[model samples]
Target: MKILQAPFTEEMMRSLRVGDEVAINGVVYTGRDAVHKYLHEGGELPPGVNLRDGIIYHCGPVVMKEANGDWKVTAAGPTTSIREEPYQGQIIRDFGVRGVIGKGGMGDRTLAACAAHGCVYLHAIGGAAQVLAECVKRVRNVYLLEKFGSPEAIWELEVENFPAVVTMDSHGGSLHAEVLRHSQAALAERV
Candidate 1:
């Protein structure tokens, strides 16, 4: 598996191709619908939260607060990435984001942005929230909790060997598109 971490560079993202399995270690930030819309609408990221060369995970993790006021992620599953298609491209360009982790893939706009901005879209496992949470080594921080609630908040996570498959690459490759193309052609042949 390809190993990835924070401060992802253009060269690193460019080298990845669709279908490459990667193990991402280090920092990642969870950004659901609210967080995406907020960022797209020109809202500032909380102080200390920087997305430059960073990875944004489309997830609404199940978290628990401890007696010490620390946080724990009981589950970390990917949300449907298609929901962010309208804002993803712009977010990648404006925020200098290098990676996006989610499920169900995205649209042409997002793929184009990945190609243009040296970014990659990784498909995380669906229905494996608890299993994936095992990769989360720590809860670093969180933002917009009071405003957007826990699930919709931006959660800073430190992960180890977080697994994902690259469905869209910076080189204009998309496994999701390929699957759709082949499926459509097969259906047409039957007709």
Candidate 2:
């Protein structure tokens, strides 16, 4: 329910079944697209940085300056997960990241990796960026600025009660696949 880091045990991940709503507390990293490519391509993360046993967030926030000109998140929703399909599984294994937060669903390869690695994929609500931003206490820091542009930069966030649902579990259960199968079968009956 409340965790600061990943590399969580298999029992912890399994206890959190697909569709179990959760509120996360503590630190997390934001990364997507270009970051994934760079990591998989053997480009080392800047020195002193390690994602091992951390949670990676698939998000690109809309940030704004406060009255004092300090940047604050305006909209901070999860990104479509399918884009990372190409690199996710390998990244997870290579980097030792134990959790991923994104919108929508990942593919079979990612699901398989989760099973192999005792990881979990969490899905945050798609259109609730502003609301989610409210939960972010502060933008602790950022990284990977040059290649990925600002959007692809990694944001270190401090959060409290940040809402999400478990969509994929370490046991090889996938809420996304289950939902799709049910939808397809229902459509077939109508046709």
User: Using alpha carbons, what is the TM-score of model 2?
Assistant: 0.91
Which pairs of residues clash in candidate 1, taking residues 3 or more apart in a chain or in different chains? none
Worst 10 residues of 1 by lDDT: 3-12
lDDT of 1 at 81: 91
> Lowest lDDT 10-mer window, candidate 2?
1-10
**What are the TM-scores, per candidate, against the unseen true structure?**
0.97, 0.91
Candidate 2 at 142: error in angstroms? 1.0
> Which candidate number would show the highest lDDT if scored against the true structure?
1
lDDT of each: 0.94, 0.83
Residues 1-191 of candidate 1: C-alpha lDDT, one tens digit per residue: 99997668889999999999999998999998999899888999899899999999999999999899999999999999999999999999999999999999999999999999999999999879988999999999999999999999999999989999999998889999999999999999998
For candidate 2, write residues 1-191 as lDDT tens digits: 54423335456665777878878776788898888888888988776456776788899988666898666877899999999999999988988777899999899999999988878898999989988999898977777766677788888887778888999988889999999999999999998
